[model samples]
Target: MTPPAGYTKAKPGEVFRLKRSLYGLKQASRQWNKELYALLHSLKFKQSTQDYSLYTRTQDGEFLVVLVYVDDILVTGTSTSQIAAVKLALDEAFTIKDLGDLTYFLGIEVHRNDKGIFLSQRKYIKDILVDAGMEECFVAPAPLSTGLKLSPEVGDLLDSTPDVYRRLVGRLLYLGITRPDLSYSVQHLSQFMHSPRVPHLKAALHVLKYLKGTLDTGLWYSATSDLKVTAYSDADWSSCQFTNRSLSSYAVFIGSNLVSWKTKKQQSVSKSSAEAKYRSMSATTSELVWIQGLLADLQIPVSLPITLYCDNTSAEHLPENPMFHEKTKHLKRDMHYILEQVAAGFIQTAHVSTANQLADILTKSLNSSHHHVLFAKLGLISKVQLEGGI
Candidate 1:
């Protein structure tokens, strides 16, 4: 604490102290983070390199993991005693109230049974529906219309304020955390946040209607899931009519449990479907590598040569084939990176038929039946359906 230039008071070593909580200050979060980091380090927990928010400590062959999100912290692992100790330490230090079990945290609901754990944002979705005045909306068969192609300039700019559309898209983006089925649709609607049109607004509302019908749908983690890492990568080549950008998507799994997935438009335009698909594979490989590191930090062993499934035969062969085609000269960097991983036995590429491509749901809009089929394969389940409810 530096003294004011004009002040000639007191001792040189005297420093000003903060009398109030740092709740509203910008530096509050940073200071809190630093303090928490120091405390966790003192507890012998190693912060994960893959994710700084994650910390892990091992004692007597048991693992204790801590996940931090601002003030909300989640403690879990193989050792219950260590978790309790850590909680007590945190409470004594910061006066935190322990929320028993992990049923709810940060707006996500967790359900556990003998089978496994189920994660959902059902109440969050309901809140969104009510905010959009769609609580009584007619339920659609799917989140997106079959074969629908959204164009930025197709319809008149929404007569209502564009904030409505922007807010809806933002909420839906957060909802996608547990709802992989909404990934592609939310990604599509997000593109027009700058200047959303009437058609775009309608499509966003359609998603709300679908949400009303499948309110209980969410990812299911099976207790018996293997530790094997498998990933499915796909691309909708040149899918955007206006930008001509291809959509790349991947679904990553730890055995049969879906852990991570993404649907994003490619930043650069690809000349061929193979190139687009290859780019998608590159993205998926990066995610797979990160997941492997994170699992290792958690003391979980993942087998090598993680299977990466792609629908394009050419893309699948690009990493293994020695000869590079003239047309693929532009993708040399991507090819080299993928090949490096393949050579080191970090990942193995396999050709999967489009019909069996689970990531197809993330790359493009599919017919109702096809969408549901792929959705089922993505490890999404509905609690209502399990209990024989419509």
Candidate 2:
């Protein structure tokens, strides 16, 4: 620790004393993390290099996974007796609360059954709707209306209570963690957070209405999943009216279960649609490589040459061959990382029709009918519908 500005002269052997632990202390979280890591290490758990909070261990064909958040611990494994033994050891070491199964964690509700696990933030969504006074609003088929174009400069300033719009948009962003269907809508509304406009607020209201209709919608992770890894890559060129930057989106799956998805604006502008698509492929490939390594750490074998599907053939060709149009040449020079992964047989590029692109949902808003089709294909479904409760 460094001394205060005026008290820089500290003897090498001098000791600093501390009082009782307090909430706002500078080292509170760090101290907690270090202590927990040391204790887990003593238990023979190896910390993950990718995520420090994650710990894993294996013994006699049984695997255990542990994740720490501050003082809370989430523990799971293949062997029931092993998990029980871990809990007993922790109870002996420290005063602990064992929240039996993970029915809910971090505001995301978990529903499990013979089918699989269903993740949703329904209570969180309802709170937002109530705050916006749209709890009774009419339902919409999709979060964003077709052909709805929003810009920072289009509409007049929100007359009163602009902060309401800002607050709602922020909450919606957090909700997207479990609701990928809301990704495009929330990302669009976030653009005008600095100075929201009337048009933007109206669009945000549309999203709330969509959520009302799809209150039970969420991601479904099946227990019968296979280890086959495949990913879909997509890009919407020049989708943003304010910045003209392309939107990149991809959905990665392990068999029929969706494991990862992303919706973000590209940092650099692309000259052609193929350029935008190829750049998106690079990002998706990076995520796929990371997932492969993590699975390997768990002793799970991923099949060789994971397949990547793209809607554009030109974008697909960039990875298959070295020579191409001006767009491909520029991308190759700047993004040789993705090209090398392909050249070494780490990934195999393939073409899929645009309608079959699961990533399309994250990149742009389609009409109500098209949106519903893609929504289900992305492994998102309403819990009520599955249970015959809707």
Give the runs in model 2 whose Cα sits over 4 Å from its true position: 1-16, 19-21, 324-327, 333-335
TM-score of each: 0.93, 0.91
For 295-352, candidate 2 gives per-residue lDDT tens digits of 8767789997889999999888777676656545667653587778888888899999
lDDT of candidate 1 vs native? 0.91
Evaluated with lDDT, which candidate comes out highest?
A: 1
Cα lDDT tens digits, model 1, 1-390, are: 788788788478899778744789988888989999999999999999999999999888888899999999999989888888999999899999987989999889998887788889999999999999999989999988888988878899976789999999999999999999999999999999999999999999999999998999888888888889999999999999988999999999998999999999999999999999999999999999999999999888989999999989889888998577689888988998999999999999988999999999998878899999998888889987544522
Report model 1's TM-score to 2 decimal places: 0.93
lDDT of each: 0.91, 0.86
Clashing pairs in 2: none
Model 1 worst lDDT window (10 residues) = 381-390
